[model samples]
Target: MRSSVILLLVGISLAFAGKHSLKYFYTSVSGDKTFTATGLVDDVQFMYFGINTKKASPKTEWVREIEESDYWKRQTHLLVEQHHWILNTIWTESAGEHTYQITYGCEWNDETGKTNAFRQYGYDGEDFLFLDLKRDEWISPVKQGFRTQERCNNETIRLVHWKNYLKMDCIETLKKLLTLGKSSLEKTVSPQVSLLQKNACSPVLCHVTHFYPSDITVTWMRNGQELKNVKVGKLLPNEDGTFQKTVTLQTEADEWRKNEFSCVVKHQSKTFRKTLTEKEIRTKNKTAAPFDVTVVVVLVAVILSLSLIIGVIGYFVYQRKLKPALSGSASKCWLSFCRISGYVTANTSPSDSENTSQSSTES
Candidate 1:
């Protein structure tokens, strides 16, 4: 029984290990003459290197800097040179402010002990070249420079070997780090949905915040049809050891105002949906002015009619019974009618009035 309990605990811990990642990012901005780079393990920065051309040579940091010879120095120099070469090759008159980023990462599955390696080079946040080292494949834009099919294939082989080497050398350390960094499983958070308008175009945004275990999907649908022009931002870390992400769908104002849009979020095998209706959108934008005005007029007419009916009933009751019994004057009967009318009007809430108006209109 003790052995079984230990095995179960181990299985649970492995289940919560999530995806382990190691990423290298390089970014250069020509307009600002700044270059920045970092090496991250599971989204935690372990090394940072940067250079501002307006300043001195370069700044460097390695958490394990002392455990090296001049290896990092040489690597940093080569990286800076490579950045300059790529920048020169891709620079254009129209490309005033340009950025280049290279990301290499591996995701490890604790349960399967399987790993997938990825390498991507992007310009201005768009992928120009991508390599799936595990599959030994490459994807590049047609107009990208210095990236040929043969070269990419060759680089893929080298990177695959390098990834294996790193795994063999660092997997144990990385696993320990991941274990230390693992967060407790928190309750799944439902996404918040809203419509945003920019440049006369509206986009529905589903923001999922403060969730655990990183694996979540956000999908947008229009009138029960899935949308293609959807933008999903990267899953980002929160300060409190949770995760957040945003998914946006770009839609035309007419479509947004006429169709039903829904944001569906799936996390931890559970699904949540937030739906926006055309009427709700119209009401939010205050474009249902005519409908609102019509409703108000109908409500007022119903209320006045109700008050008048009640007043007549009261007047008749007073004249027939109360007036004869008390020998009341005409002014007293009028007062009773006025009091009933005032009470009916004063007791009618806006919601009740609206409901009554709608019921009458429907009838």
Candidate 2:
């Protein structure tokens, strides 16, 4: 049991060991000229070498003063001449301004570490570091130039200025290359849903690969709503330093029958929503009816009432002012009645007398 425990501990330790590591190594440089460089490393240390003419190390003795053109082409175990008039040194000299190449490589220490051996050189650059040829109050190369020809020896004092100049130009170029690589990789791991086998129902699998590990998220949206009970798998980086993430949701055959389901991917600050729907979502609006009919009814009643009130007022006025005229008409009617009565009585008397005369004569 104890041996087994020991073995388990060893296994755990090995498992915990990371598969990748990063290291930054910089050498001294001289002058006002600045440079920027970047490189990719796999299980290796990133290193830079500068020149110092005043100081002599085991490697510096072989470093001979050469023409500016010859300086850039010269190559050593760790440093290489990259550009013309550039002399590369793990050290720099101060007599004059010269150019040199900065080479990047991978090195491994042997088990019985005795000698140093550098592997193949993958990349080299001309503007890895800038040197101010003139002396400033901050970093004066004249004092340190005699000891080490390398100017700009005070890295801390000039770091801010040097970093700003190099980072601006170098970062842009570095980002462009990284973007191209990302694009090329995207084409390979792009999700392609295919029906592997078709029986009464077909099962589909979505494959998404070749993505940056830090900027990736996948979710399954059912219908128009996102599914809460989704099963997401772990994301692992690919061998090419990219990433692959996936989400699996086993829905009923009828659920995806019409292909109404969709997958949404979120990366960085952008949210990409994709839906497989027949129509787009829209809002509905309705207008209420107006009060025109009610208004017309009220207006008509008001006008009729107003007219009736005005007519009654006029009738009252006429009754008050024309009373004498009405009495005059009544008196004329009475006069006519009296005249008729008198005429009737006179005619009757005449008739009776005529009748008496006729009877006496006949007797």
Candidate 3:
């Protein structure tokens, strides 16, 4: 499954940055059967291995275009090794009762050259051990993790292997992934901006949807002055591989009518300003159908009335058509029916009726 971990934005100030990360989640439990891992390019999931699946698979179309079958083989083999290692490490008398989790990953910012590689262990959802990238050593935040930290620190070979993996191999993998998923992950898409409201009395909402590169700025302004305390929603992904966000202004509708209020959004190199006005807002609320008995009864009555009117009109329309093969007597009967309905007049010459009867008899 694709990892739900949001991109770890460290010390970011709306700067242009691109980060790629590979996260490995290993659980020593019955759930998921064993292990899972996810790789994201610019916070967009490109490849992942799940619990219910047999092997790692690409999540995006571009990643599926990868021709190197060895890539998948290597990833799957590494995950299997990691699965066995974590199981052997944590498999004890307490293993059956308590679930142990191991999360190790390497994250690198390609633009700013920031690296945040980590390896963390959790016992029953509590922090046990973590790698100190700066100190180049393992640190135990809790007393129970001391033994593990000391043991891992003593294993100098394994430490070097893991550290090098994080520093060199991991970063190389990220670079390769970025290149493979460039067209999908790096493509810039402009956001769709709109002003929305639940109803006339609801707060004004600035909805920005379907954008790329999650580093975006959405702000509310009133009379050209920036407004504060607006409720900003988290950036979410759309089914079409784009992002969406919303900023809510918790104010009455009258504020917009009295003053000039607007929502300004900055994405990539483009800027959009949506002015707040009654016409700009989609005031019609998308709500569920009413459960009131009176409304149901009225709707049913209106439907029945329309059905009856259509049936009546259809019968009269059908009766107004006269068959050409009708004899004189049959024609007379048809004319009588039409005259009763006031659709046809009784204007026919005697010769006309006789010729009609002769033509009908010959046919």
Indicate the residue-level lDDT of 261 in model 1. Answer: 83
Which stretches of model 3 miss by more than 4 angstroms?
1-34, 64-68, 91-116, 121-129, 137-159, 199-204, 221-228, 254-261, 283-363
TM-score attained by model 2: 0.23
- Arrange candidates, best lDDT first: 3, 1, 2
Model 2 segments more than 4 A misplaced: 1-205, 269-363
Superior by TM-score: candidate 1 or candidate 3:
3
Candidate 2 per-residue lDDT, tens place, 1-363, comes to 234323332322221111221222333223544333323322211223334222112211212222133433432322323311233443243354433333322222222322211211111223333233233212222442333324445455554554443333233322222232322312323332211122222222233455532345677777677776766767655666556666665665445646677767765334455443323211121221222456779999999999999999999998888676676577666566644443223445777656655664566
**Candidate 1: which stretches are off by over 4 Å?**
1-12, 15-17, 30-33, 41-47, 52-98, 123-126, 132-139, 143-174, 183-204, 220-243, 248-262, 269-271, 275-363
Put down candidate 3 lDDT per residue, 1-363, tens digits, no spaces.
112111222313323346557666666663334556776666687767765675877778777755566878787777777666755655634534566787877877767788878888887789888888789899999987788799999999988988998887676666565556665656788998888776555677899998987768999999999998899999898888788999999876555668999999998858999988655777554422223457779999999999999999998777676455456698678677754543434376777666656665666
In candidate 3, list every pair of residues with a backbone clash.
none
Residue 345, candidate 1: how far off, in angstroms? 57
Give the per-residue lDDT digits (tens) of candidate 1, residues 113-144: 78766667787878778765555566686565
Worst 10 residues of 3 by lDDT: 1-10
TM-score of each: 0.49, 0.23, 0.59
